[model samples]
Structure formats: C-alpha cells, structure tokens
Target: MADQTFDIEYVANLARLSLSDEEKQQLGSQLGQILDYIDQLNEVDVEGVEATAHPFPLVNVMRDDVIEGSLPHNEAMQNAPKKLNGLFQVPKIVE
Candidate 1:
C-alpha cells in the first residue's frame, strides 16, 4: 500500500502546477492510500452479488395526475409586465 508512491511530480507537470516538497510527499501519500483502498476493494468476493447503481432499492413516490381548470386569462396576466392579445408579451430577440 504505502510501498506504492504516486507520481505526484508527473501529475503536477501535466496540470501545470508547482508544489513544495512537503506538499508533494503529502499528496503522494494520500493518493497512494486511495489506490490501496481500491486494490483492497478489488480483492472482495462478489460472485453472487447483483450489480446495481445504488445500495438501497429506489421507488418514486408520485401523486395521481388530476385534470383541473386553468386560471382565467385576465387573472393570469394581472401581474405580467407586458401583455399581447390574450398572451404574455416578451422582448423580440430575432429579426
């Protein structure tokens, strides 16, 4: 795990970054730990396990779609900044 030292210098070179010696060592160690964890996960036995996007079962709780009357044209346009013939008016953006 800790035996694998991350090529922090190479990564920094690619990212156009300048890191101090201490920072490089610290980041390299952290990256090495992450790789070690991934290696450990790779060793896990999931022969009978099902592949899933999430650990828990997901369900969408939805309400029934009911038909309803819409607001009257006058009431709907009461707070509008601009209005045309029974429609909301907007600034013209195209010729």
Candidate 2:
C-alpha cells in the first residue's frame, strides 16, 4: 500500500469534478482514510468461507405471465395531455 497521499487534482480530474483548494485537501484526507480502512480489511482471515455474490439466499418469486384483462383504447387515451389521430401527441424530441 502506498503511504503517500493521493493526488487530489488527479482524482478530481478523473471524476470530472471541479473542487476548490480547501475541498481538494479535505477530500484527499478522507479518501486516504478510506483507502487505509480497506488496507486493514486485508488482515482479516477468511479461510474456509465461501465467496458469495449475495449475503442472503435469493429466489425467483416472479409469478407466471398471464393475460388477465384489457382496457378500451379510448379509455386509455382519456388521460393523455394531447392526442392526434387517435394517438398520444408528444412534444417533438428531434430537431
């Protein structure tokens, strides 16, 4: 692990963030502490423990796909702010 403090300007540039000198110093110190904590975690022993993607058991509880009911087109169109030719008229997105 590198003991030297991380370059704040380099980190900020990588993140595309504009930080003041004060903010850069503060964030640099905070990031150093976080890196230190991660380094400490390397000391822990995890022998015999299986690496899992998730901490809890996951199961697919999704219900089977089924068609229950249908709504009339006019009824669905009633809530549209604007409509034209029996279809919703949205603002022009492309130039």
Candidate 3:
C-alpha cells in the first residue's frame, strides 16, 4: 500500500481547514493509526470467502404504498396565521 502515509497539511489545505500545529500533528497520528489498521486487515487470508455488499442477507422492510384520504382544504388551513382567498399568504421571498 506504499506505506499509506498521510500529509496533514496537504489534506487540511484540500479541505480548506485551518488547523494549529498541535492539531495537525494529532490528526496526522490518528489518521496514520487508522490506515495501519486497514493495512493489517489487508494481510488476512480470505481464501474461499465470498464477496458481498452486506455481511448478512437483507430484505425490504417497507410497506406497500396505498392511496390515502386527505384533509379538506378549509380544515387544513384552519391553523394558518394568515390566509388569502382560501390559501396561505406569506411575505415576498424574492425580488
């Protein structure tokens, strides 16, 4: 993995972040450790292991969509702070 080295300053510049020297050093070490763990995982044997998007089987848990009743316009507009001509009114938003 070509040593998986990280450049904290370069990454911060790319992200448009301004970090103190201490913060840069700390984040660099932390990210380095995370990359080392990933490298270690790459060394494990995976012979005969099947590749999968998910570790376990998944199923759609959503219920089927169905037509539903809607509230009457007058009833739905009852709580409006302002209404004009059977519709809600608001301040102008754009020029």
RMSD of 3: 8.6
Q: What overall lDDT goes with each candidate model?
A: 0.84, 0.84, 0.84
Q: Better model by TM-score, 2 or 3?
A: 2
Q: What local lDDT does model 3 show for residue 89?
A: 100
* Model 3 misplaced stretches (Cα beyond 4 Å): 2-4, 9-19, 52-55, 67-95
lDDT of 3 by residue, 1-95 (tens): 62446777888999999999999888887888887777877788999988898878778878669878899999999999999999899999999
Best by TM-score: 2
Estimated TM-score per prediction? 0.38, 0.44, 0.42
Q: Which of the two candidates, 1 or 3, achieves a greater TM-score against the reference?
A: 3
Residue-level lDDT tens digits of model 2 in 3-26: 558788887899999999899888
**Model 3: which ten-residue window has the lowest total lDDT?**
1-10
lDDT of 1 by residue, 7-94 (tens): 7898899999999999998988888878787787667899999899878866896778988899987998899888889788888889
Evaluate residue 64 in candidate 2 and report its C-alpha lDDT on the 0 to 100 scale: 69
Misplaced by over 4 Å in model 2 are 2-4, 7-17, 66-95
